[model samples]
Target: MSWLVTGGAGYIGSHVVRAFIEQGITPIVVDDLSSGHREFVPDGVDFVEGQVQDTSLLERTMREHDVEGVMHIAGYKYAGVSVARPLHTYSQNVQGTAAVLEAMQRVGVSRIVFSSSAAVYGTPDVDLVTEDQPTAPESPYGQSKLIGEWLLADQARALELTDGATPLQHVSLRYFNVVGSGTDEVYDTSPHNLFPLVIEALIEGRTPRINGTDYPTPDGTCVRDYVHVADLATSHVAAATAMAEGRELRPVYNLGSGDGLSVREIMDAMQRGTGHTFEPVIGERRPGDPARIVANGDAAARDLDWRMRHSIDDMVTSAWQARTAHPDISE
Candidate 1:
């Protein structure tokens, strides 16, 4: 049986697809290609170009591919942009997730691995965030993600209450600051993302700017958890495997590093990785920016085999290697 990977052609989704392929599992892709590239879907993989909101299309794709599970990664991911486009964000994330779940129920596919975000914690007051942390999303994107988790939980419960119904086993992986490229063929194309923005500026011979430098962190800039995309992909695969093997799993897990790196530390790694020596220009801190928001991934470490396998240097080096190899990313 194959798994349907929504947004399988996107950066993190593409890595998840590769991980599934490497493990000899068949992956069928359904992506609209709004921000994702078609070429990112590897050769020989079944690809269907469509939005997640189209329930008819999703049901057809699952039925045709004999999909037994889903890895839901398709959504509008721009936090800053979502502030201006709240309706569009809900349309894509909230409504779109509801559509995916509806299609899953229609096709009787019960297993899912949701791609969540730490944005749900919004400017967390504590230094270390845990799964039990109060969710108080500040942005439309974050609210949408939290709502998506609720939809999944409610659906699972609904299924459990149905007579002769198979309980929907699912897990949501919340994370922050995903960077680095698992392969040169696919890189983060987000216009608002930090790593890509820095790499692009450096490649174009322009100095990258830091948003703020007055935070309470060691270097003044904000500190946040950063995890390698490959490691995140591995945990996704592990979650899927555990579900398929009938192993008990948590409803939610944080794919995070207990310790985090400040923006200054990231800039230092980028300089060493890209051979750029220019200092970053500091700009006014964006509104609602948190000083520090790291998470304890001990739960995932024990269950999903999650670990910080790559350092800041390794993340920068691999990301730079891919960025340089794919010069068109700067375009």
Candidate 2:
């Protein structure tokens, strides 16, 4: 049986599919090509071009592929943009997740690994945000993710109430500033992300700028966790493996580096990796900017084999390599 990965044609989803292959498992891809590339699905993999919101299509794909589990990563994932498009965010993330759960229930697929986000924590007060902290999402995208988590928890509870029904085992992975390219074939293409923005500026002969250099940090810049995409993909596969093995797993896991790097440090790495030397222009801090927000990944480390395997330099290097490989990306 194969694991169906929703949004399998997207950047992170593509990496997850590759990781499953590395673990000697089959992957079935389902994507609508909305913000996902068709070329990223890899040859020899079964792909169904459709949205997760279409429950009938999802059910059909699951049944046809003999799907044993699902990696639900399809969603409208831009947090800043979601502020302007709240309805669209809820429709894609909230409604889309509900449809996936319903399809799983119909097909008796008992395992799911959700792609959650650290945005659910908003501007956290603590330096090292833990899973136990209360969720106070400041944007619609974050609220949608938190609500998706609630939907899974509620479904699992409801399934337990059904007599003689196999319990729905699921885990939601909260991602924090996912960066780096695991493979040259797949790299982040989001317009609003940091790495892409910085790389695009340098390629276009413009200086990459940092926002708010007066933050309460050693570098006078905001500090945030940046995990390598390859490492994140491996943990996602591990969660699926544990579920397939009938091993009890936690409800949620945060993929993060316990200590994070600053924006200035990231700029330095970009310069070193891309061989570009220019002083970054300082700009006003965006509203709701947090001085620092790293997460404690010890729980995920103990359970999901999560670790900071790649350094900041490694992240910048791999990302630059991928960016250069695709000559037209900056254009």
Candidate 2: which stretches are off by over 4 Å? 287-289, 329-331
lDDT of 2: 0.91
How would you encode candidate 2's per-residue C-alpha lDDT over 80-142 as one tens digit per residue?
788889999999999999999999999999999999998889878888888998898888988
**lDDT (CA) for every model shown?**
0.91, 0.91
lDDT score for candidate 1 against the true structure? 0.91
- Maximum-TM-score candidate: 1
The sequence of per-residue lDDT tens digits that candidate 1 reaches over residues 1-331 is 5899999999999999999998788999999999898999999999999999999999999999889999999999988788889999999999999999999999999999999999899888888999999999888999999999999999999998999777898999999899998898878878888899998888889999899999888889989999999999999999999999999999999998999899999999999988889889989886545677899999999999999999999899999888788766447
Tell me the deviation in Å of residue 138 in model 2.
Answer: 1.4
- TM agreement with the true structure for every prediction: 0.97, 0.96
Worst 10 residues of 2 by lDDT: 284-293
Specify the highest-lDDT model's number. 1
Candidate 2 pairs with clashing backbones: none
